[model samples]
Target: MSLAETGISDAPLILGSHTLRSRLIVGTGKYDTLELMQQSLEASGSECVTVAVRRERLYDPTGRNLLDYIDFHRYTLLPNTAGCYNAKDAVRTAKLGREILLGLENPGADWVKLEVLADTKTLLPDPVETVLACEQLVELGFQVLCYTTDDPVIAKRLKQVGATAVMPAGSPIGSGQGILNPNNIRICLEYLKGEDPDYPVIVDAGVGTASDVAFAMELGVDGVLLNTAIAHARDPVRMAHAMRHATEAGRLAFQSGRIPRRLYASASSPEDGVIGRTRQDRTSQ
Candidate 1:
């Protein structure tokens, strides 16, 4: 069935307490300016945006804060632990994010995007540290969206540890490799959502363009989380618009169901019915 026939609310992406309409989650980093970021975000049609708790000026003393530009009511402020290299630091950052946002009247204040990197050079997530931090954050009453490698075992582990969402990277951070191992991603999705089909398995990072985002969505992931791809584009706003449509298109194609491939070609016209030749013509020939 077509998505239009089913409707927009047919399968909403539910993260924590929020039911999000848009599947694409953008990041509020790497943009040249706040104004540009706002424009791009609007164009992207993203309901949730990740903001680095460490880098953003949540409360600027000079009356110039990142929060000043963002409309808290319009978008979900998903605070992330981007720079943390260990479980302790990541947990600390998450706590700080909660403390900072609890004062604000936003529903996403309790949710955190957890990432514990092994090193700066690789920018790959530390599986052990990520799982550890997720456990602590879940215990602390925070809805944790874990960013980890595309490993089925680790994804299941994260879910077991109470991660609200399992975001497996398409590739290394900032590499833009774009789903280096689709098979691995598929496995992660299957294992995590084996029993619960609605389980959120988002593809985070390594998306270089609109096609990449579409492809990821085609894989039946619940959603996508990206930053640099749009932020670094020459025309960020236009790219954001493309991504928005691409995500919808990909999702619609998946829902509509694609036909299976065959080794031999099949004729569209009926073999029993003839348009140009009749029985008399065949006998004369």
Candidate 2:
């Protein structure tokens, strides 16, 4: 059946306990101002957003928090462990995020985006520490959406440790290099989805622009999570709008099934319908 008839175009993305209509998951960081961030979020059409777990600004008596501007009812708040360099730190930050979300009465308070980096230079996740954190978090009853490298074995290990979603990096965080290794990303998706067709594989980083997001979606990833691509753009709000459309267009194209690659050219106009050329004349020529 055609994609239009199959209704895949209108399908909602199911991630763990949440069903989101929009596949784009943006971050709340690096924006010039909170108001601009809110405006960009509204323009992106994202149903879920990621926020880092950090200290409360209790020092400033009149200071407002990020949650003050965001409406929790409309968007799912996915708290992430951004600056943690080890499993212990990541676990502690995740627990703190849960506590903060619970205090705010957010619906998906138990869900945390886990990122345990190896160092500050590359910002690449440590596979060993990530697996350990995932196992501990799962045991602690947190729905873990793990940020990992593009290694298929590590992806499986994360899934095996009871992670809800395996988020493989398209490149380093905030690099804006786009998908540096599409082959590795594709292999990860294929291996993970082959195990469970409904499993969520979100491309978590290195999306420089709309085409980068589209390329990830075309590889059949369930979602795309990015920050710098939109937050660092010259016009963040406009880039958000572009991302919304790009994701939808890419998803539809994937569902439609593209034509197979070929070395030779195929003509659009029929050779049989030429008015000036008869069968004998064409053969003789």
Candidate 3:
């Protein structure tokens, strides 16, 4: 189905200075081939794509670079500090990305996807370090999109530190466990909207399928950022298409407003309908 048919036309979605046509944000990793990656991204209808920065590989001619395949004019490149361990590392990497990837044209590098992992096992954000980095980055004139946990307190702190959006993980990176704690995500959403109604809340990692994307949108999330789920799928291109559709469906469902759950049966059929009547009558059968 088309995005319009799915009812995504009304969701308030924005990224940096550009307004996105689709609420779903896709990643540019894990594709088997660059051609497939392009197809998947196009099918996903994502206006923004995330790309990781590594210092050692910056000059590698044969290495895969997002700029090599993606048309920069068409998509906004959201460079990320993926493997950084602390605020300093993240800031340094972000600065390099701004110079090499974003270039002099978009000198500000306006948006930075901040990820500072505390541990290698779970890849959870260290709130202390993350907040420190966020404050520094914001002061440096960058629009910080922080990757964080689903804790309401951490989210609040991130916002207070000048995060443009608070991205809480559904689970660990690449776990594909879907949303581990719906209540926490809901609380994060509540806290964000309450504190700054315009601040965006994006679901960042552990999204396994289209349903996970849909669930996040339905929860009033502004957007989603995922990678491994689509890239590692059996057919990555097809999975990308599914992700796009799922996000649109979820956004539409939210805008329309879901029905309230009830303990007792409440049928849509008319309560005054005749008990039992057939056009053929009882004797006919």
Task: Say which candidate scores most in lDDT.
Answer: 2
TM-score of each predicted structure versus truth: 0.90, 0.93, 0.90
Q: Candidate 2, 217: how far from true, in Å?
A: 0.6
In what order do the candidates fall by TM-score, top score first?
A: 2, 3, 1
**What are the runs in model 3 whose C-alpha is more than 4 Å off?**
5-8, 56-64, 104-108, 275-285
Query: Tens digit of lDDT per residue, candidate 1, span 1-285?
Result: 734677654478897777999999999899999999999999999999998876555666686678888999888899999999999999999999888778777777899999999988989999999999999999999999999999999999999999999999999887888999999999998999989988899999999998998899988998899999999999999999989988898887778788898998887987566878888886785
Which scores greater on TM-score, model 2 or model 3? 2
Q: What is the C-alpha lDDT of each candidate?
A: 0.90, 0.92, 0.85
Clashes of 3: 0
lDDT of 2: 0.92
- Per-residue lDDT of model 2, residues 29-100, tens digit only: 999999999999999999899999877677796897898889998888999999998899999999999998
| Best prediction by TM-score | 2
User: For each candidate, how many residue pairs have backbone atoms clashing (under 3 Å)?
Assistant: 0, 0, 0
Candidate 3 lDDT score at position 139: 96
